[model samples]
Target: MDLGPGRRAVPPRFVLPDVSEKNREGKRTARERLVVEREKQKAAERRRRALIVGASVVCVLALAAVVGVLAANSGKDKKSASDGPAVAPSGATGKDGLAIPVGKDTAKSSLTVWEDFRCPACKIFETTYRPTLHELVGAGKLKIDYHLVTIIDDGRGGSGSRQAANAAACAQDAGKFTAYHDVLYDNQPDETVDSFADDSKLIELAGKVDGLDTPAFRKCVKDGTHNSWVVKSNAAFDSGGFKGTPTVLFGGKNLAADPTMTPAKLKQMVEAANKG
Candidate 1:
């Protein structure tokens, strides 16, 4: 190009690069990295959820298995307790062989006592009248027919009464019923505590009686041999329509209901009956 009249030639100018386009490219790269990070976080969260669900399912299955096993054991125990014929104790007598005689059969007067081992009142009655009862029984003037019942077990929700009564029946089998019976009343626990529910505890108590804690006795107790018998006895008690335990009856009279009755009076009554 020619300039007019002494115009100098224009020099070429250098062009700068577009800075905004470079910034836009950098922004696109940052966005891509952010999207990748978000996808990775979502994938990790899904895996974590799946692991939690799997662990929960395993725990539920384990719990169900444990419950099933427990239910099966419980059913077996029930069947064992109620399925077979009730075997009466050795030398047990009375209707359905329910009574355990504590005195001679030839006694002139009979005292029928429905008792529960876990009964507090029965314990009191035994404690109060034991000496007189022993004297009369020794003299052969009066006989006692003990009808064991599980009234406490029925009412208070425990197996102590039934277990103890079964143990007493086991003692009867060993021909040590009278002595072991006395021992039980002597060391009876509180009615509220079902310590006697444990067969081991019952066996321990049997150790107090001489020659009572034999292998046979332990086996009888551990196996619950007379549990069915005890259940039948309790059923008999329910049918009798008599009141609570210590239902002592002499000559068709409820002696325990006689508020004025005493040990001496009981002796006199037995003597009178003998004379009659």
Candidate 2:
């Protein structure tokens, strides 16, 4: 049998290629590739965000550590009143946290001390000579009161004055004003970034002194209830012509803001009051 030159016998049941199906497969593949790319992009974004957050946390922690170290190292060595007597807290709480002994309101030679908690000099005064003053107060010869101030060096986050005052207030409510007062001075922080505004430090400090309930102290600090007292004290300080801390007023007479106001000077002043 003759056949066309280009014709050949075709086999039965041969597989036919489906163009539309191939196109569908190609489209599916493209869709799957697009989905994978989107997933990769999302994962990359998440990783970037995590990295940024981690870096920020590291930086904050590093800064805080440095500040704490500097503060720890900057404090001047304090000399205690070795020859003077020790005093006890009267355990009195006034309208604010101002604690005064309850008795006949006799006019003793009083000293109104102006202090800023962030003031290093104030720390020295509080640490070195406060015990002597305490002795005098307990002995009914002298009365010492605090005038709080919060003047920041550059308006950075300086919570030294406020924290100290508020903690004192909390301690006052807990009947531990003097003890808490000493602790603040003892744990003075240096002038650095992340200074004294740290809530953790305040909490740690509160835990150290007895009679101050931690939860109550934290709430008081967060609410800033004692800020008004600090404000009033600052106003009083301004009225008294004070520019810095440790400005003592002996019998209402202004004393210098010297860091070197020794125990001898304090005793001499008290004795002079006794003579008069």
Candidate 3:
């Protein structure tokens, strides 16, 4: 370009770069990179939290399952303890070793007498025919197999029947069963009164019979050694479908049920069976 006349020619000035604008752009880029890095960090933290919560739920469920199993096993153990094994007494005979024999095995006439110590009617029958039965037993004309039962305890609400029966079995163990048996009937408590449920009471009753209140007998009664055997005998009675206590059967006849049956008639039947 030509300058005006009388004016000195001047060179054109160059524009300098704007350093403030470049600094602002650099700052904006840095801010964008920082934002991206923060988003990545947040995503990683969320994944970690989810993993922790899932693991906690699994642990809790496993703990509950273990607790449930242990509780079930504990309940089963308690049940097993209460309902233990059925153990028969020493020298028990008959089906399931239930009968307690009072007479000799060689006797030809055998009498099946299902009796309960707590039964009022049984006490009556015992008192009425005890002498004749004893006479026949002493003469070796008849044998009596006493099946001790707990029907009273089953029907009524008391453990007297079972407890007394267990005591009688203890007497059998001590070889004083006949003496103890008579004593039990002679001093039997009322059906409503469960005095015989006490082991001390049963032991005291054993004092009436000689050599029946020994330590072994007392231990047998207290420890309930024949409790399982008594239970088994009662179960047999139930399955036998017999009527009730004092079910005296001789020669296929329920002698106790016979309206005209007497002690004389029993003796006659036994003598006849023995002769035959």
1-276: candidate 3 lDDT, tens digit per residue: 111111111111111112476576764554464355345435644565666777688879799898988777874532122246555666778877888887788899999888888876677678768888999999988888898988767645578888898899889888888899899999998666889898899999999998789999988887777787788787888788776666888877777556556677778888998899
RMSD of 1: 37.1
On a 0 to 100 scale, what is the lDDT of residue 260 in model 2? 35
Off by over 4 Å in 2: 1-107, 153-157, 257-261
Please, what is the TM-score per model? 0.72, 0.57, 0.70
Question: Stretches of candidate 3 above 4 Å error?
Answer: 1-82
Worst 10 residues of 2 by lDDT: 6-15
Give one digit per residue, the lDDT tens place, for model 1 in 1-276.
111111111111111112476676764554464355345435644565666777688878799888988777875784247556798999989999999998888999999988888776677577667888899999999899999988767655678989899999999999999888888888888766888898989899899999999999999998889989999988897788776667888878777667566677788889998899
Supply the global lDDT for candidate 3. 0.73
Ranking 2 against 3 by lDDT, winner? 3
State the lDDT at 148 in candidate 2: 58
Candidate lDDT (C-alpha), each = 0.76, 0.54, 0.73
For model 1, what is the error of residue 165's alpha carbon versus the real structure, in angstroms, after optimal superposition? 0.2
**CA displacement after TM-score superposition, residue 208 of candidate 3 (Å):** 0.6
